[model samples]
Target: MRLGAHISTAGGAYRAFARAREATCDSFLIFTKSNRQWAAKPFTDDDIAFYKDAVAEHADLHPVSVHAAYLINVASPDAALWEKSYLALREEVERAGALGVDFITFHPGSYMTSSEQEGLDAVTRAMRRLLDETADTAPNTVVCLETMAGQGTNLGGRFEHLAYVLANAGPSNRLGVCFDTCHVFAAGYDIRTPEAYAATMMEFDRVVGLDRIRCFHFNDSKHGLGEGKDRHDHIGRGQIGLSGFANFVNDPRWADFAAHLETPPTEDGEDGTTIDMNQVNLAALRGLLASSSA
Candidate 1:
């Protein structure tokens, strides 16, 4: 698997490539715009050129995925919010296309007060609309819907829910999945053991058809199984522990996907958060994989 982390894109889109390289990442994730804010400064032509040049320079980095903003809610019951969400997502997709990224990952969004079926329909419609809008520009870029934590009315926590969206989507292949280990564990998939991990993947294969899994958010949860909590703890320091990561890292099926660390930084230093504990966690995971195979 290509190991990486979600690096900051504060300076410019291209700068994230350098940041990821500094983190010793073979792949990386970035947000095209500020995740928390609805409006963002428009990207200049220079930004696009620089981003393309950076990607060309880092040709060895197989896949660079862009994470969508947190404010989007395609499944929102509120019509105004839903429209804004769709527009924002369309803009992000366009931006990713300009940067030459192949995948954009986003949470499937919450249902709010709407029924689950209605929410699913709304999400599907929004996605179809976005695809239609960007059909001419970003034909190669796939939008990856992420599995949620099942907190309150949030959707896509279940394998069937994701499968449903994929099946109903107009261009099925245009849609994919970014599976979060913490959310799955919180949603009650036992992946801490080899046997359980296998079982969980088997279930995913049966329901969502593992082929749809394009990216992974490699976060260990702070909560226990079936807790439905979305708290993310640093690797091994959380409830999932090292064994769980070992099981995942050793899995041959995820070899081609980008497994990214969304965990917090380790320590502070003069050079902007000098120490990153995620590197240690990734090294430990690699060591575990090597030892297990040996």
Candidate 2:
């Protein structure tokens, strides 16, 4: 699999490429804009040129993706906020397309006080509208709906939620799924053992057609199964231990797909030492591949 992490676009958008390249990654993800902010400065022609040039410089960065802002809520019951989210996501996709990003991940949003069916319908409608707005350039990009931790009334926690979105969306191949291991485990799909992992995957195949899944967010859950928490921990040291990661890393079906680490970033502490946790987590994942090799 092509493994990487979410790199910061702090200094400039193009810097994310350099960061990922320095990490010796095969792929990487970025937030096109501040993930907590609702508005963003438009991407200039220079921005696009710089990003393209960086990608050309780093031939190994196969697929650079963007994660949508946390504030977007297309599934909200509030009409004004829902429309705001639809436009926000539409803008995000436009920005990603401009940057030559082929993949973008977004949470399917929460229902708030609405019923589950209401939330599903809202997401379906918003998706249709968003797709319609970007139909011209969407062929170059795949919008991935991320699996959630099922906290509160969040959508896409269940495979059924994903199925509903796919079934209701416009007939477009650009729509896909991004499976986060931590969220999947926290949402009650067991992956800590061989039989359990196989069973959980089989269920996904049956309900969501594993074909729709195109990427992975490789995080171990800090909470236990069925906890519905969204905590992420470094690989092996969490509730979903190395056994879980080994089962996933060894799965031949996802060999060509992109998997990225969303674990906490490395912080510089007192001494001259640095703590890049992604390296540790990524090493653990790679070790699983060798140890589990047949």
lDDT of each: 0.86, 0.89
Runs in model 2 with CA error above 4 Å?
267-272, 291-294
lDDT string for model 1 (25-137, tens) is 88988898999988867889999999889888988875999999999999999999999999999988988887778889988899989999989988988887888898877
Cα TM-score of candidate 1: 0.95
Runs in model 1 lying further than 4 Å from the true structure? 268-274, 291-294
- Which pairs of residues collide in model 2? none
Q: What is the Å distance of residue 73 in model 2 from its true position?
A: 0.3
**For this target, which candidate reaches the highest lDDT against the unseen true structure?**
2
| Candidate 1 residue pairs that clash | none
lDDT of 1 at 193: 88
Task: Quote each prediction's TM-score.
Answer: 0.95, 0.96
